[model samples]
Target: MPAIISHDTGTDAAESLVYTSQPPVYTYTTSLISYALPPSQFVTPETPQVAVGAFIFTPPGTSPPKVLLLRRAATDSYPNLWEVPGGGADPEDTTLLDAVAREALEESGLVAATIVEFLGTVEFGTSRGNWCIKYNFLVDVEEGEVTTNPAEHSDGRWFDLEEVRTLAVTTELMRESLVKAFERVEELRRSRGISDPVS
Candidate 1:
């Protein structure tokens, strides 16, 4: 089993991993969305590999908001398994959050507009025996058609909570992350007065 660690910025419950370091905030804005970097740990030379994931939901006011999930290409590591749009952070990425926005756009053709919150981090061992720490966040994206990169992902769709529970997610950690994202969305809706029928 791959080692796992999480830190949910939306809650007060402490977990095995707690990120207190606040890096400089960076912002990226599109016509529809404004992406901002939240307080998070920086990637250092000691870390072998780091990845970033974006959990984006359907626009507000939808009966039951759905989160986007991508189907990995048959030739990819977890072929045909569904996962969020993300990948390894590139050296040119100014910050971990920048990687999140870049990967989301590259994989799903969605521009990350606003980074809602930092969901947490997931640590797992790669197939090559290297360890990778992936940081995930709840993001809002500009209105656009979902088009996945054929080489990396075969398909992409928005799935409701029930559908997500039944799908073949890439990893158990990923499923948990998706579930938490749903819960967070619900909270946001209630707080913002966006009416959503209970599911």
Candidate 2:
């Protein structure tokens, strides 16, 4: 298991808590990543219907890094729209991070290797008239092919930052999240003295 590291913004408020893990040396395991606690807001939801979204990037050496996105099946809620791999957290999930890894695997057949950063969260009303809060994270997955589930998603593709602007992403919040993810990716690369193709 990778060491879990977290930082709080010196506040007892729920939204101030942020959890992350130290960068891991890629290894294959059933428990791919570990997390401490999700923000109180997500865990204490009145309905306990929290969801998780993952923003996975291509391996470090891939020039012009891209993010994986899956197109929803026509029968789904956001029919035919492109979005990151994610869904509602299940009771069987040990932690919110587990939900992240599970959703990625079930929806896109990708194994999460590390929980890089907490992107943020979004809350919206569901079709059933209940609010759903989704915690988004930046994740690094093991090297492998992507096989999206035909029932939940119709197609899956890696889109560079430029190409993301051209796709019909699920929602405005999701579009903003993608932009923030790209910015975060560039920051991470620069911090490690890696050259960014767009820079």
Candidate 3:
């Protein structure tokens, strides 16, 4: 049986991984879909990875700002722990922001209205032997229902400012990320008039 891998969001997206004992074969599909990298590029286990976080914010209206947090399945990293919707930057994504948006929609069915700002970057080494630079982004999502991608998250919900402040997690890092995400959203909302009702 051959293993397969795919990259769907970059300047060079290599979709499908064909693993065999052979020396590897390259095939050009379409004008927009050929990637030069081989299967080796997909085997990045210990490599320091770059990740993008989607801090998808909802308007305050008359209440405090809220952001979506997804708790990954126990089989996944940070199992059963809540974090912003996002994932690592793939070889296909043109930018970190695009990864955030792509991962967010994949994890939770929500589209960002716009990427408001880049909060900052945080470096962390996981227990699973992977180190990553997590790039956090603040995004304004169009008002609508949020649907969770069951494969990724066991639970997903929007946590308001106060709930965010007290959300439980084992690490200070995640706590800080959520707190910071809320702060940034507040600043973005007020400065950009995001919650202002149109007359």
Candidate 4:
């Protein structure tokens, strides 16, 4: 597991560090409190489904970088809300990376060209008395047009980072995770010398 740090305020040599394939690593404290997940209402009923989300970003150049977001269909669980490409794990998936790859492709029709960064997992309790661990990752996608499944999402588009924070989110769970993902993505942008007009 990678160490999760709050940010890079500790390093003045951050520029050199960011050029590498991996981001700066830091450690975090964990609680010893014993907690068990109730029967899940999602992928399974006995354990939290190990899900994954892919935060796809365009390269930093000619234009400001953009991240993809998809709007859920009005009939889906979190209807008419924006989120990155992701979904629950299935029986066919052998590992978390496979699940992430499959989910990203299924949800947004984008294939992973390379795994850029691991944004860590966010654990949250579900209304059904169960908890879920969502593993988020940043990846470069293969060149292709994004095609959203009409049954899954109403529409899909790439949005600027600033605009993403202001949109209506489907769940408080994802809203918090999204914020953290944005921070990591921004850090990546800065490391690559991408100019940000937001600040």
Predicted candidate 3, C-alpha RMSD: 11.5
Clashing pairs in 4: none
The digit string of per-residue lDDT tens for model 2 on 36-80 reads: 434233565555568889888876656787889999999988899
Model 3 Cα lDDT, one tens digit per residue, 121-194:
77778767688777776655545567776767888887776776677653678778877766655554565455
Residues 17-127 of candidate 1 have per-residue lDDT tens digits of 221212212232231122223313444555568888888888767868788999999998889999999888877665566777778888988766555577788888887
Instruction: List candidate 4 stretches off by more than 4 Å.
Output: 1-47, 126-129
Identify the runs in model 3 with alpha carbons over 4 angstroms from their true place: 1-47, 192-199
Better of 1 and 3 by TM-score: 1
Clashes of 3: 5
Identify the leading candidate in terms of lDDT.
Answer: 2
lDDT of each: 0.71, 0.72, 0.58, 0.61
lDDT of 2 at 188: 75
Per-residue C-alpha lDDT of model 4 across residues 100-132, encoded as one tens digit per residue: 667777888776554455677777665466767
TM-score of each: 0.78, 0.78, 0.68, 0.70
Query: How big is the positional error of residue 58 in model 1, measured in Å on the Cα after superposition?
Result: 0.4
Task: Give the higher-TM-score candidate: 1 or 4.
Answer: 1
What's the best-to-worst order under lDDT?
2, 1, 4, 3
Which 10 consecutive positions of candidate 2 have the poorest summed lDDT? 3-12
lDDT of 3 at 107: 76
